[model samples]
Target: MAFGIFDFLSLIGALGLFIFGMKVMSDSIQKVAGNKLREILEAMTSNRLLGVLTGVLITTMVQSSSATTVMVVSFVNAGLLSLIQSIGVIMGANVGTTVTGWLISQLGLGKFSIASMCLPIIAIGFPMMFSSREKLKLWGEVLLGFAILFLGLNFMKEAVGGLQNEELLSFVKNVDYAGQPYIKQFFIVLLFVAIGTVLTIVVQSSSAAMALTLVMCNEGWISFPLAAAIILGENIGTTITANLAALIGNVHAKRAARAHFVFNVFGVLWMLAVFPFFVNLIAGASVDIFGADPMKTATGIPAALALFHTSFNILNLLILVGFVGFIAKVVIKMVPSRSEDDEVFSLDYIGSGMMETPELSILEARKEVVKFADIVRRAFKYVPRLVTEMDEKKLRYYTDQLEKYEDITDRMELEISSYLSKAAKGELSSNGGHQVRSMLNIANYLERIGDIYLEISRNLTMRKKKKAYFTQEMRDRVAEIAALVKKSLDLMVENLEAYERDIDFAKAEELENEIDETYKRLRKEYIKKVESGKFQVRSGVYYSDLISELERIGDHVLGVTESLKKDNELIVEE
Candidate 1:
C-alpha cells in the first residue's frame, strides 16, 4: 500500500489523540492531588537527593518529564524551590520519563496488548467521571485518559503498519551502518540524533516522539542504534519546554531552565563520545533480560529501546548528580541578575503563561499576592513622608513616588485577579477554588489600601496648596495615626505570609481597634481646636480627611486578614 495523504493525516490525528490523553491524565491527577503535591514539593526539595526522588515520583505519576521540568521552573520563579533544589528535580525527571517508554514497550507493543482492553477500561471509567466526589471524578478522568492514550498508540501502530512496505521507507531500510567506517557511523548516529530532536520539538512531547521512534523501529524502518540516537536527541529536546516557559519568568527562573538545558546537553555530549559502546552494552543487556537481540529482530526493538532509554538517563544522572551545584553555577554565570531596582514594576512570582498545573499556578499567584502586600506596605511609608516634608522638590518627589506606587498596586491587582480568574476556570479542588476567591478578595483590599495612601498624599498636597500649614500638635497627631496604620499594614503582611492555620488575626484585630479609637479621639480634638481658633479651619479639614483615610486603610487591612481567615474556614468545611 502507498503512504498517501490520508495515512499521514491519520498519523497526525493519532498523535493528537495521544497528546490529549496525556494532558487529560496529567491534569486530572494534578487536580486530585494538588495540595498534597504542593506540600510534597515544598518539603522534599530541601536536599538534592530527596529532590531527585520527588522529581522521579512526580514525573512517573504524571508520565511527562516536560510537565515536571516546567513545574520546577515555575516553582523556582515563585521562590518556592531554590535553583540548586530544582536542578536535582530536573535530573530525576529525566529518569522518571523513561517510565513511559517502558509502559509502551511492555503494555502497548508487548505480546499481550493493553490496547485491546482500552475499551473495557473506558467503560469502567465513564460512569465515575460524573461522581459528585472530586477525587472520584478526577480518577475517572485518569482512567479515561490512560485508555485513550493506548488507543491512540494502537491507532498509531496501525497507521505505521500500513506504510511498512511503502517505497517511502525504502531509503530508511537501505541505510545500513553495520559495515560503515567508525567516523562515518559516528556521523550517521549524529544525523539520527538530530532527527529525533526535531521530531520531539515538533510534537512538543518527548513521550509522543519516543512512541513514534519505537513504532518505527518495531516496523523495521529504523535500526536499534538509530532509535537509540533519537532517544538521546529527545532528551535534549525535552528541555525546550522549560526554557520556553522561563522566557516570561524572573532571573532565577531563567537560570533554572538554563540549568536543565545545560545538564541535558552535557549528558548528550558525553554519551555521544561513547555512543557505540553504550549501544552495545544496552543490546547485551536486552538479550540477557528479554532473551531477544534488538540488533537482529524487530520484535525485540521496543524492549531494547526502553531499556536503553532508562539506563542512559540513570547513568547520566549518576555521572552528573554530584555536579548539580557546578551546573547551577554555570547557568547562574550564563544568566546574571539585573539590578533589584529594575524589577520594581515587574511581577516577582507569577509569569505571563499558565506553564504548570493549576495547583502550581495557584502557588505562583499566592507568592505574587505576598509581593503585592509588601508593595502596599512600602507605598504606605511614602504617605508619612509626604505629610511631613517641607522642601517643595522633596515633597514633589515623594508625591510622584506615591503616584507610581498606586499605579503599581492597580496593575498588580488586575494581573493577579486575572490570573486567579483563569485558574478558577481550570479543574480545581474545592479548597483551591476557595483559595482563589480569597486571593481575589485580598488583592482588591490591598489595592484599596493603596488608593487610600494616594488619597492621603493628595490631602497633604492640597493642604500645602491652600497654605493650610499644620501646627506641631496637628503634625504629631497625624504621625501618631500614621504609625498605627503602619503597624496594621505590617501585621496584614505577616498574616498573608503565614500558613492559614498559623495566621494570628489577634494582633491585626487589635491594631484595627487601636486605629479606630485613635481616629475618633483625633477627630474630636481637631474639631475642638478649629472651634477654639487654635487651628485653621482649612488645615483642620485636611487633617480630618487624612485621619479618615487612615482609618479606612485600617479597615482594608483588616479585610485582607479576614478574607484569608474565611478562605481557611471554607477549605476546612470542604
Candidate 2:
C-alpha cells in the first residue's frame, strides 16, 4: 500500500492537534500559576545555581521549554533578569524539557496506553470547566489538555504505523546506517540533525516536535541514533522560538535570546563530536534497564530515546554551566546595544506581544510606564532650553525636539494603554489588575505633562514671533518656577523607580505645595508689574502662561505619585 496524500494530511493534522493541546495545557498552567511565578521571579537573585533551578521549576510547571525561554526574554526585556541570570535559567530549561520525552515514553507509548483513558479523563474535566471559580476552570482546562495531548499522540502512532508498507520500508532501509562505515554514519547523523532542526522550526514548538519524533521512533519509522540526532537538532531549533519572540524586544532581550541559541548550538557541536560514544552509552544503559538492545528492535527504542534526550541535556548543562558567563559575553557581542537615538520611538519593556503569564506582562507594562516618565522628564529639559536658547538654529532644534517628544508621548500612552487593556483581559491576579489601573493613570498623567511642555514651547514660540521679549526679571521668575517644576518631575520619576512602599509621597506633596505657592506669588507680582506698566502686556501674558503651564505640569506629576500610592494601598489591602 502506498502512503497517499490523505495519509500525509492525517499525519499533519495529528501533529497540529498535539501542538494545540500542548498550547492549551501550557497556557492554562501559566494562568493558574501566574502570581506565584511572578513572586518566584521577583525573589530570584544573582545566584546562578538558583537561576538554573528556577528555570527547571518553571518549565516543569508549564510543560514547555519554549514558554520558559520566551518568559525569560520578556523578563530580560523588562530589565527584570540580567543576561547572566537568564543564561543559567535557559540551561536549566534545556534539562527540564527532557521530562516530556520521558513522559511520552512511559505513559503514551508504554505497555498500558494512557490514550485509552483519554475520553474518561475528558468526562471528568468537562464539567469542571463550567466552574465559577477561576482556579477550578483553569484546572479543568489543564486536565482536558492532558487528555487531548495523549489522544493526539495515539493518533500519530496509528498514522505512522501505516508507513510500514513496502515502499516506505525500502526508503528506511536505504537510510539505515546500522552496518554502514563509521564515517558514513556520522554524515547520516548530520543529515538527520538538519531534518530535526527544520521539523522543529516548522512546528514552532520543540515539545510538539519531540512528541512527533517519539511517535515516529515507537512506530519503527527511524532508528534510535537518528532519533537522538533529531533531538539534538530540536535543541537548536528550540532557540528559534525565543529569538523570534525577541524580534520586537529591546537589546537585552535580543541578547538573552541569542544566548539561548549560542548555548544550545555549542552543546550540539560538542555532542556531535562524541555522538557515537554517547549513543553506545545510552544503548548500554537501556540494555541494563530493559534487557533489550534498542539498536536491534523498535520495542525498546522509545525508552532509549528518552534516556538519550535526558542524558544529552544533563551532560550539556554540566559541561557548559561553568561557562555561562562566557556564553553571555558571546551573545552580548553578537547582539550589541543600539544608541539611544535609535531607540527614541521604541518601547523598551512591553513589545507588541503579550506574555503567557499575565502578571509578568503587567510587570513589563509597568517598566514601560517608568520609561515613559523618564522620556517626559527629558522632554521637560528641552522646554527650559527653548526658553533660554537665543540662536535661531538652536531654538528651532529644541522646538522640533519638543514637538517630536510630544508625539512620542502620545504614542507611548496609546501603546501602553492598549497593552494594559489586553493584559487585563487575561487571567490577572488582584494585584495585577490594580497595577494595570495604576499604570494607565500614570501613563495618562505623563502624557499630559508632555503636553504641558509642548504648550509652554508653543507659548514661547509665539513670544518669539511677536518680538515680545522677557525682561531679565521676567525670565528669572519663569526660570525659578521652571526649576521647581523640574524638581517635581525628577521626584515623580524617582517614585516610579522605587518600590511602592518606598515612594516618598511626602516629598512629592511638598514639591507640589511649593510650586503652587510659587505660582501664586509670581502671578501676584506679575499683576503689579502689568498694573504699573513696568512690563509690556504681550511679554507679561506670555510669561504668565509659561509659569501656569509649568504649574500644571507639577499638578500632573503629583497626580502620578497619587496613583502610585493608591495602587500600593490596594495591593496591601489585597
Candidate 3:
C-alpha cells in the first residue's frame, strides 16, 4: 500500500500494455470477421425489435457495443440505412453488448500456461513483433496482445492482492456508503457516472471500463450495488465516442448518436430507480443459484456484474423500443433533412460516415457519386420543361434553377473530391484503390458536365435577356439533343451503383453507342440549317453550344461506361 512513484509508473506501464494488447486483439478479430459484418447489417430496419437484434448481433461479433452503434450511425448517414432503422440498431447494440459481460463471465480469467508451452507463445509472438511483414506484425501484435492482456491483469491482481496485507483491508471492508442515505447514494451514482464517462473517454474503449470494473469488484474495493451502478454508467459514457463523431456529421448521423445517448440515459435512469431492490434481488438469486451466502463473503461479484448488464439493457429495450419511431421523428425535427434550396447538395455522409473502413467507404463514396450523377439527370429533367414552356419569365426561372443545379455539381465535386482524398490515406485493397481512382475520374467528368451546364445556362440567360427568338425547327433540334443526353446521363448514374448487380450491361453499352451516333447526327443537322441561311448565325450560337453541351454530357456517360469496363478488367486481373 506504501508504493513509491516508481511502483505507480510500473502500474501505468502495465495498463498501457493492457490497452495495446486489446487494440491488437480487436483489430485481428475484426479482420477475421469483417466480411460477414456487412451482410448481417444490410437490411437492418428502423423498428425497435430488429434494431435491438442488429445491435446484439453486431456487438456480439465485434465484442464492443459502442463499435456496433458507430457502424450503424455511419450506415444511416450513407443513405444505406435510414434513421428509423438506425434506432433499432442502437437499441439492439446495447443488448448485444451484454454478451461481452457474459463472455467475460465465461472466461477462465484465472487460467493460461498449458497452451503456452507448445506454442512457446512468447517465442512466436516476440519475433513477430520484429517481423518485416506487416500482416505478420499485426498477427504478432495480436498474440503478444493476448499475452500482455493476461500479463497486465496478472500484475493488477498481484498489486491489488498485495494491499490485502495492510490497512487497505480495513478500508476495503467498510461499506463506504454506510452513512449515505438515498441522497448520498444518488450523489454516489453521479460519481460513478463521472468515473465511467471519464475512463471511457480517456481510454476510448468501453471494454477497458468493464475490465476495470471487474478488477475493482474482484479486489473487494467496491460493493455490488455501486459496481452495478458504475456498469450502467459505463454504457452511457461509452457513447461519447460516437457522439463526438456525429458532431460534424449529417442529420441522420447526428440522430444516430442522439439515439445512442438517449438509449444509455434511459437505461441508467431505470436502473437508478430500482437500484436497491434489484441489488437485493440479484444477491438473493445468487444465494440460491450459486449457493452464494450474502451473510458471509460472496465472490459471485462477476455473476452479479453480468446480470446487471444484461437485465438492464433488456429492460431498457423493452421500454424504449416502441418509442424508436418517435426518437427518429424528434431527431428529424431537430436536424431537418437538407433541402436543395437550403444547401448546394446534401452532405449526408461526409464526416459522420462509417466509411472509415475501406469496404464501407467505397460504398458510401459511390452513393455520393450516384447523387452527383443524378445532377446530370436533373439537367436532363429540365430539358423538356425548357422546351415546353414559352414564357420568358418561366424559361428564365428554369434557367436560373439549372444554374443552381450546376452550382450544386461544383460543390458536390469538391465535397466528394475531398472525401475521397481523405479516404485514400488509409490502406486500400486493390479494388478499393481502384474505386478511389474511378471515383476521381467520375468527379472530373461530372465537373465538366457542370461546366457545360453553366455555359448552356449562360447562353439561355443571354438569349432571354436579348429577347432573341428561335424558329420551331431550331427548337426541335435542340430538344432532340437534350433528350438524348438526358437518357445517357440516366443510364450512366444507374450503372454506377448497379454495375455489379446488373449482369446484362450489353443494352447499356448499346444505348451508350446510340447516344454517341445521335450526337453526331444532331451536329450535322445544326450545320445544315446554318448553311441554308434559314438559321441566323446569332441564333445558331446558342443552338450550337446546347448541342455541344449535350454531346459532352453524353461523352461523360460513355466515359463512365468505359470506366466500369476498366473496373471489370481490373477485377479480372485481381
- Model 3 Cα shift for residue 398 (angstroms): 22
For residue 434, model 1's alpha carbon misses the true position, in angstroms, by 32
Residue pairs of candidate 3 with colliding backbone atoms: 45-85, 46-84, 46-85, 51-88, 51-89, 52-92, 55-92, 55-93, 56-96
Per-residue lDDT tens digits for candidate 1, residues 1-574, read 7899999999999989988888888889888887877767766534779889989999998898988999988877655677888899999999999999999999989888899899999999999999999889999999999999999998999899888778977877778887899899999989888998899999999999999888888888898998999999999888899999999777888988999999988988999999989999999999999999999998899999999999989999999999988998899789987744223565667644673678889999999999899888877878888777899998997887777678778878987998898888899988888889999999999998878877877878888989998888988998999999989888888888994657888888899999999999998988888889998888888888888998999999999999998998787777
The whole-model lDDT of each prediction reads 0.87, 0.87, 0.70
TM-score of each: 0.66, 0.68, 0.60
lDDT score, candidate 1, position 525: 88
Error of 1 at 307 (Å): 0.9
The residue pairs found clashing in candidate 2 are none
Please give, for residues 114-224, the per-residue lDDT of candidate 2 as tens digits: 998999999988998999999999999999999999988999998888777758556653586778888999999998899899999999999889998888888778888
Candidates' RMSD to native: 12.6, 11.5, 13.6
Worst 10 residues of 1 by lDDT: 339-348
Better of 2 and 3 by lDDT: 2
Error of 1 at 322 (Å): 1.0
lDDT value, residue 514 of candidate 3: 74
Kindly give the number of clashing pairs for every candidate: 0, 0, 9
What C-alpha root-mean-square deviation, in Å, does candidate 2 show against the real structure? Answer: 11.5
lDDT of 2 at 111: 82
